[model samples]
Target: IRAVGTGQDALGEVTIRVREGSRIVQGKGLSTDVIEASARAYVDVLNRLASGHARSSADSAERELAQGGVARP
Candidate 1:
């Protein structure tokens, strides 16, 4: 969730769900200053996604070279 407002005003917050294994991110901006808040939230989700990708790639490579590796069909 990300939000920007003079906050005590009537501005509503924006909420979004981030998906893994895909880069199609999305969002919404409710208040007049929504752009700033939306950008911040997008960046935060992107950073987390980047880190997850790095970890999964490292793990996959390690398994590829592991001893007695499972044979593929």
Candidate 2:
């Protein structure tokens, strides 16, 4: 993560990058408050990770069920 003062209305520009294996995700946030900008950048990465996990888990579950796997109670 990197942040820089944009020198415009006391705003800040933040760049966030996340890497998982061969997958890479990037996000940018700009705000008059530096903290807010940082938080936004972090949340963006977190949301992406959560979304990927949910999708992958669902796909795996479907594959398992299709292969005659049982769903435990």
Candidate 3:
């Protein structure tokens, strides 16, 4: 995770990266409010993680099976 603030009003830019197995997911946020930017960046990554969008479908299916869940056909 990396965050930077600039300008007089303190515009914020945040970058969040997450790694799962061989996959790497990145999220970015920019806002005048630093806290809002941070939350947006974090939530962006969380949404991807929750949706399994960072991993390949095949990988996700394999993981599901390993966890005793039904695999997608």
Q: Between candidates 2 and 3, which one is better according to TM-score?
A: 3
lDDT of each: 0.51, 0.65, 0.73
In model 3, the runs with Cα more than 4 Å from the true position are 1-10, 55-73
Tell me the lDDT of model 3 at 55. Answer: 70
- If ranked by lDDT, best first, what sequence of candidates would result? 3, 2, 1
Candidate number with greatest lDDT: 3
Tens digits of per-residue lDDT, candidate 2, 1-73, equal: 3435445566677877666654455566778887888889888878877787423444545665899996321
Model 1 misplaced stretches (Cα beyond 4 Å):
1-12, 22-32, 53-73
Quality of model 3 by C-alpha lDDT: 0.73
Give per-residue lDDT, candidate 1, residue 30: 59
User: RMSD of each candidate?
Assistant: 11.5, 12.4, 10.7
Return the lDDT, model 1, position 71: 25
* Top candidate when judged by TM-score against the true structure: 3
Candidates 1 and 3, the one with greater lDDT: 3
Question: TM-scores, in order shown?
Answer: 0.37, 0.52, 0.53
